[model samples]
Each structure stands twice: as C-alpha cells, then as structure tokens.
Target: MHRLAVGINYPAWAGRNYRIQTASTVVSGLGNAAAPIATAFAVLGAGWGTAEVGYVTAARTVPLVVLMLIGGAVADRWPRHVVMVSANVFNAVSQGVLAALVLMGHPPLWTLLALSAAGGAGQAFYAPAAEGVILRAVSAEHASKALSVFKMGMNGAQIAGAALGGLLAAVADPGWVLAGDAACFAVAALMRSGLTQVGGRRESGPSLVHELRVGWREFVSRRWLWAIVVQFSLMNACVLAVETVYGPVIAEDRMGGAGAWGTAMAALSVGMVASAVLMARWQPRRILLVGNGGVFLFGLPALALALGLPLIPVVVAMFLSGVGVTVFVVGWMVALRQEIPEELLSRISAYDAFGSFALLPAGTALAGPAADLLGRSGALWACALTCLGLAAAVLLVPEVRQLERKVPEARGNLPQPEPATSG
Candidate 1:
C-alpha cells in the first residue's frame, strides 16, 4: 500500500527505470562535456592545427546528420533501450581506441577523424532511441516533472564536467581525459542495459526507407510541429553562430578574452538549471504558448553584444536566455511524449532534431564571413533580429498558439508501468 501510494503521488523519478536512465544521462553528460576539451588539446599536442580540427569536427557531424533517419528507423524496430546501450557500447569502443592512439603519441589525423566519425554515428542512433526511453519508463502524470528533473541533472552534470575536464586537461595528459570519457560511456551503457522491454518492440516492417517515408508523413502532418521546427532550424542556426563564433570574437575585441565569454556561458548553464527546477514544480495550461513565448529571450544576449553591453549585462542576458530556452526544451519534450504516437515518437523526434540541426554547420561556417562583410556589430544585430523574428513568426501558427496542455488525456493509451527487472 505504501509503495503504491508513493508511486501514485510522486513523479516518475520514483520509478527504478527512470532513476537508472537519469544516472546514465548524468554520466554521459560528464563525458560529453569533457570530450571536446580533450579532443582539441590532443589534436594540438599531436602537431595538428586548426584546419585539422575543423576536419575532425566535420567528419563527426557529417555522419551524424547523414545517418539520423536510419538511426530512427533502427531504434523503432527494436527495443529503444537496447539500441541506446548498443550505441553507447559503440561509442565507448571508438573513444577507447582514440584514447589509446593518442596516448601512443602523434596519432595520424586520419585516425582521429575516423574515430570521431564512428562516435558520431553511434550518437546518431543513440539520440533517437533515447527520446522514447524516458517516456516509456514512467506514467503520464509525472512525465513533465520527470523531464524537467532530467534536464536539471544533465545541466548540472555539464557544469561539473566542464570544470573537471578543464582541470584534468590542464594538469594531466589529455589522453587520460579521453580515457575517462570512454569509461563514462561504458558505465552509461551498463546502466541503460538494465532497462527491460516495455510495450514490446515496434513491429518490424518493410525497409528502413519505408519507415522514414512514414515518419516524414507523420512529421509534416502536424502544422504546429513542422512550423516550430522550421522556425528553430533558422533560429538555432543564427543563435548558435552568435554564441560560438561571434560572441568570442566580440569578447576579445571589447570585453575580457576567453574568461569573460566563459563566465557568460556559465551564467547560461546556471539559468538552465534554475529554470528546469521551476518547471518541475509548475504546470502551465497552454504549454506550447508559454514555452514559445520564452523564445523571445533567445535573442537578448546577441542584442546585448550588438549594443556593446558590458560583461555584467551580457551575462544577465545570457542567463535569461538560457532559462527561456530550457523552458521550451522541457515543454517541447512533454508535448512530443503526450501528442506523438508511441510507435512513431522516436522517428518523428529524429526529424525534429534533423531539422533543428541541418543548418547549424552552414551558420557556423558563415558567422566569420558574415562579420567580415557586415562588420561585427552589424552581424550581431542581424542575428539577434532574425532570431526574434523567427520566434515571433512561429507563434503566429494558430495550432501552436492554441494548443493546451493535455497530458492526461493524450497519454491515456500509454503502457502502464511494469515491475522493474533491472536497477
């Protein structure tokens, strides 16, 4: 009776599977945070330069983008948790090999690129499979809070991981850091391996191509869904460019160098964590409207940079934007779980991710050129205004504006929680 009451009253975090999934996410988050820092240092230490770094980055991203649809189909055909574990295992192997080669000294640039691509391919599969795992683990009543708490855990891990990765890279061989990343993935794989089958595997069908076609049909069927995705495709491209490329250059010219930029990023992370905590407790009526409303804040930091605001004000902008973006992310995940059919969820999510990510490379590549052509302030101003415009325009979609929270009703068909088989 007590256990049942506890299950009824508490959020999804009460379930053993959700707890395990959260643990895996935190551990993987730490690895993800550390891997980039370590990878960059390892490249430089091996006599490679920035061009080689770009090649390695592109190598990883290309496979991830190319393979996402196939990954989604593969996840649907099997138990999603199993796919997640397999993907992590593949990543652990690739990272472990990279670590070994780096430690051996002066590893060829080609090897690094290959291993990185392998890891990215693994991630492509892992990502889509991951979308359904949490939703499957818990009841609808607790899903919103569960996702918020999950994001909080991931953000917190990233903060700790960044600090730890920097320290480890500065004081020790970056090979060791890469090794630690491999270990983190291995551990996460083990944790995820414990999840038992829920609602069974999605029925295997024709070819993966067929599955993708079906997924695309589902994706384009919803006006609200596709509209927001299209908006984000453009918005994320420009916003990320500002954050990664323009902001640093501007900081160097005006505010303090890397440290000032780092502080602002830290502020953003803190805001994300804080807002995740808030969303876990507060249930809003019009989830999409409330979530989309927060997106206006996305352009604030860019606007501040354009206006030559000092570090304090820029940091404040960054923090607020972080909070706003996180609110949308948590809300978006809730919407996906509630509104999407169980079988189609992972595939549609893959489309959503693909849309959001498709333009990112172009944006990053163009940021420096845009600044050179338009002048620094001009570029910043353009990105900020474009982001704001996209956010506003997305809200004009009637479905997005009118959709209300229907978690309970939408999730009535979800599978009931089964007894835990793995901890």
Candidate 2:
C-alpha cells in the first residue's frame, strides 16, 4: 500500500515540478520523432535524394544555430514558462502547416524545407527557456534524479515515436504522423499552462551584447566546460555528421526502408532508457571525464553502418551509442549547473548548445556530397576514425580529464520569481 501510494502521489512527490517535467518530456520526445519523419517525408514522399535531404535538414539547423544567442538572452530576461509556451505554439503552427500539406499531397521539396526552417527557429527559442524552466522546477539536491527522470520520459517517448514514425511512413502516411506530432506540441503547451514563472529575475547588465560578453567570459573561464564543448564539436562535425545525414538515406536503399531504420532508432532509445534510469539513481564523481570517455562508443553505430553489417549488429551498435549520448547528457548538465550561477545558466547553456551543435549544419551540408564522392563506406570510415580518435584526444586535457562536481550547500536557491504555491 505504501509503495503504491508513493507511486501515485503526484502531489507530494516532486512538488510543482511534476507538471513541467511531464510537459518537457513530451516536448522532447515528440520533437525527436517529428524531426526524423519530417526528413523522411521530404526524401521518400517529396522525392528528395540524399543530398537534398541533407540540405533541407541543414536549412532548419542554420536558423537554430544563428538565433540561439538571442533565444538564450530572451530566456534569461523573461519568465521561462511563458517563453516555452510561446515557442511550442509556434512549433505547433509550423508543423501543423507542414502536416496539412503532406496530407494534401506531397508538398514540393522547397516548401517542406521552408517549414522545417520555421520549426528550427521555434526550437532555437524553446531550447534555452525549456532548460531554464526545468532546471528550477526541482529542488537542487534532486537535480540529477529529476533530469534523469525527464530524460527517461524522453527516451520512452522516443521508443514509441520513432517506431511509430517509421511504421506510419512505411504503411499509412508520414503526413498523419506529422499531424500527431503537431498535436503533441499543442498538448505539451497546454500542460505547461500552469507552470509557475521561474525566470523573471535577470542579472543587471547594460545591453544584450554586454550580457553575451558576460556569458562568453563565464564560458571560457571554465576550462573543463570549454574542453568538453570542443570535444563534442569535433565529434559532431566528423562522425555524428555522417550518422545523421547519411544513415537514413542509405537505410532506405540497402535496408528495408523507414520501418527498419525506425526499429533501429527505437533500439537506440531503449539503450538510452537504461542509461537514464542508471544516471538518475547514481551521481558519479569525475562525471565529466567518465562521460566524455564513454562517447568514444557513440561513433560505433555509424561505423557498423559503414561496415555493411547485418541489421541486428547495426542495431546493437546504435544501442551502445545511445547509452553513450545519455552519459554525456547527464555529465554535461550536472557539471554545468554545479559550476555556473543560476542567473547565467540559460545563456551559458545556450553557448554550450551552440558549440555542441555548432558544426552540425556544416557537417550536414557536406555529408551527402562527401558520401557520394568517397562512397558511403569510405565516408563512414573517415568519420568514424576521426570522431573516435579526437574524442580520445580530449582526455589529454587536464581540466576535462580531472574535473569533479562539488555539490552546493544551497542548491535549489535559484529564484522562482512568481513565488509558486502548489495546491
């Protein structure tokens, strides 16, 4: 009876955080599902080839990267919940239009790509605000546990969403799947309707440039932070680049198409679920070093794809790679929160987000062409080798290799400007 009650006790479990946490997980999970299907819709239905798929995806990433700084600044300046709600609404509208077109008939490649760019713009604004909102929802002491749970929900959603996306694309229609995704964003926004504003307070700064400069200074001051960012940037550019752009297109030709790729994606999400559950309960020392080291495994899935391995073996590689991504997610968030002041958290997070995905657009742009020129296997070999080697090289940096988290005495002291009261 006691365990059952605890399981069902939404009120006392995590206080005001329950609502926002649920919403965030939905947002992340649905967003993940939508992105890949959106790509497939452009490729399979709209008749975009691999190169066009890469370019269309890059169209979304370009605006996201360009506008992240402004988004972070806005997040720090306003109520995070409000910012998030606005962003989700934009996402709903953008995707809703795309879904409508896809349902009507195959939209032109340009139209699909343009709408994708709109969604990316919304993502730019949402990412920092959502991070800030979730960060403040839970008590500081339970940060890792809360984030882990949040990630677990996202992974769970990914399992369902990715598989569903593939199944729909294979059987029904990707447009129908996209429509569901838009509805999810709407539902997510509704869920966040009551989340108390936690971002009203802002550090006293003269101007946006001044604030950004401050964020930049704070970012560079932490050698460990910058080192990890540098590591991920290279990894994304060289290896993840190949995986994201090339993997799907190749699967369409070599494997069974969207459904097989989706199953593989679901397998990856299953691995992430394991990672989230473990990280939620265990906060490790030297997380930065340990996490970064684990990323060496992340390149394996693409390597398997490159090697022309069987589906089962490729799925296994993806599973390990998923685990590696979660390790980085946990380590990076916890370490950054522990080290950086709350007021500047969003901005700093933005910088990290920018850096982590900094080269993604460039990589996406080049990946298709590179694969065409070098052969998919040759490109895969180059990417896999470069990522694994560079990630290992980051350990040579003393700051990243030796960093440890020291818990703050008052961890949950960040402002909730609206003084929220749980009913």
Candidate 3:
C-alpha cells in the first residue's frame, strides 16, 4: 500500500520544472492538433490556389526573421513565464479570429494571411521565452534529460495533434476545429500563469539593438552551432518545399487525396515521438556527429518518393524521416543548452531560429515552379541529393566531433559553472 501510494504521489525526480514540462506537452499537443486542421480547411474551403496558400504560409517567416531578436531581448529582460503567457494569449486571439473569419464565409486571402503573420509574431516571442523557462527550470546536470523530455513531449503533442486534426477534419466543420485550437492556446496561457517567476529580474541599460548585436556575436562564435544552423537552413528549405507542395501533390495523385497526405504526416509525427522517446532514454555521447548523421537519414523519404514506391512504403519512408528529424532536433537542443550561457540563451536561440527559417518562404514559393520545370519526382530526388551532400559536408568539420567532449556538463541536473570560452 505504501509503495502504491509512493508511486502515485511521488515522481522519480525532483523539480517543479518536470511538472511544467508535462503541462507544456499537453498544451502543445492540443494546439498543434488544431493548427493543422485549420490550415487544411483553409486550403480546401477558401479556394486558395496553391501559390496563394504557399504565400500565406511563407509570410509568417517574415516576422520571425525581422522581430525575433527583439522578442528574445524581451524574454531576457522580463519574467519568462509572463512572456510565455502573453504570447499564448496573443496566439489564442489570432486563432479565434481565424475561426471567426472562416465561419463567416471564408474571408479574403489577405485577411487570413495577415492573421497568420500576427500569430507568427506572437510565436517569435513565445519560443525564446519557452526556451528560457526550460533553461532555468532544470539543474545543469539534468539539462540533457530535461531537453529530451521536452522534445518528447513536443513530438508527442504533434503526433496527437496531427491525428486529432485529421479525425476532426473528416467529421465536422474546420472552423470548430480551429475554435478548439484557440481554446488550447487559452489553456496554455492559463497554465503558464501558474509557473513561478523564472527570469529573476530584468537587465538594465543596453539598447535592444545593442543587445541583439551581442547575441549575434555569441551566435557566430560557435562553429558547430552555426554550422548546424546553416545545414538545417538548407535542409528545412528542401523539406518544407517538398512537404508543403510536392508531397501533398504526389499523395493526391497516387493515393487518392488529402486523407492520405494526413496519414503520411501523422506517420511522420509518430516516428518523431518514437525517436524522441529513444533519445530521452539513451542520451548520445557524441552529440554533433550523431545529430548530423541522423539528419542525413532524411534523404530516404525523398529517394523513396522519387523511386515511385507504393503508399505503404512511402509512408514508412516518411516515418523514417520523422525519426531522423526528431533525433537531430533533440541533439541540437542538448548541444545548445550545454554550449550557450543561460543569460544569453534566449537571444542566441532567437538568432538560430531566425537564420534557420529565413529561407523557408522562398523555398515554398519556388517549389511549385521548380516542380513544374523539373517534374515532382525529379525535384524530390534533387532534394534528396542536396540533403545528403549537406550532411557529408557538416561531417567534415572537426569542430563537430570535438565539441561533444568539450561540453562536459551535458549528461545530468547539476548546476553549470560559468563558461570559460564562448562556443
């Protein structure tokens, strides 16, 4: 009876952060499920051409690139929980607005685009604050484990969200699904309100631009960090182009329709969740090498599609790609947590986000025309070759191999000392 009680009441670990992590996972899962279905509905109901849909999706990147540094600085200067809650509120409003617009008979494309941009701006702020909270919540020794748990939660949420979104879309009006998404954001905001003050106090004196420059300097000094960013920038561009445009087009052509595309996407999410769970249990020693190596595995999906594999096999390939992506993402987060200073972590993270995602819009916008010229299968093969090349190039850098050893604090929840040298 005592043992049963202990199992129910006491977690295996100590820290409010773990509880916060769990809350985050729930919120993320609910929100993500709503987002994709809303997006799917917008595409199907609004009579938005492929190019217009791409444009709306791509426009979100603009704010991330432009205001992300400012958002990071705000996170550094304010209580991270406050920032997070506020951002969630903003996201909730945006989703609510989108739902209303859609229910009111599909508003103009420009209006939908504007709302997406507004939500993107909110997300730019939310991401850095969330990272700051994670950094502060757990002890240094537990950083890797904490990050692993966080990644697992996020991927799990995405998987659930995708599945839910698909199911919801199949049954009822998409506006209702979007409304539910807005509710999830509201709940997330409420949950964040319960968190303890995370950022201690605000820093004094420096202008936002000056702070941003300092962050840029810190970001550029790390060879492994920046190298991975560059590699992913290219990788994201390729993957987004294919997934957003070509993959759906192909699925529509071969497998019958959007439902099949949703299944493939859900498969990818499942793979990611599986990968994150594995990494959480078995933290890798050689972080950079392992991360990049896994990223290279994304090529399999592109190759499979290009080779005209059957639906089942193609789904398997997508799942494999998801696994690789999850590993790479968690590994990179672990590396970042180890390498960067907590004080500047948000700002640096913002820079990384901005730089890595900047090209996504261009990739999506160009994919249609490129597919037209090269053919869908041919374009996918090109993406596969490019990803493979980028992975190989990243492997050649000595810094990627050496940084793992240099980061001694990556294994457990111990408090980290001040960094002696910038990465």
Clashes of each: 0, 0, 7
| lDDT for 80 (candidate 2) | 78
Q: Candidate 3 regions off by >4 Å?
A: 1-14, 201-203, 405-423
Best by TM-score: 2
How far off is residue 182 in model 2, in Å? Answer: 0.9
RMSD of 3: 6.1
lDDT of 1 by residue, 23-50 (tens): 8999998888667656766766677644
| lDDT for each residue of candidate 3 in 1-423, tens digit (9 for 90 to 100) | 223222223223435655764676577566665475456456656776556656766766677667778889888878888988898899899989988887787788888778878878888998888877776666655555666677667777776776676566656666777777888888888877888787766557788888888999998988887887888788888887766666666765677555666677778877887887787666668887887778877887788888988778878988999899877877787777777888898998888887788788787777767777888788889999998999999887788876662334444334433322222
Report the Cα lDDT for candidate 2. 0.77
**Candidate 3: residue pairs that collide:** 33-161, 141-412, 141-413, 141-414, 142-412, 142-413, 222-423
TM-score of each: 0.84, 0.91, 0.89
Model 2, 182-213: lDDT tens digits are: 88888888877778767785666568888888
Using lDDT as the measure, the top candidate is 1
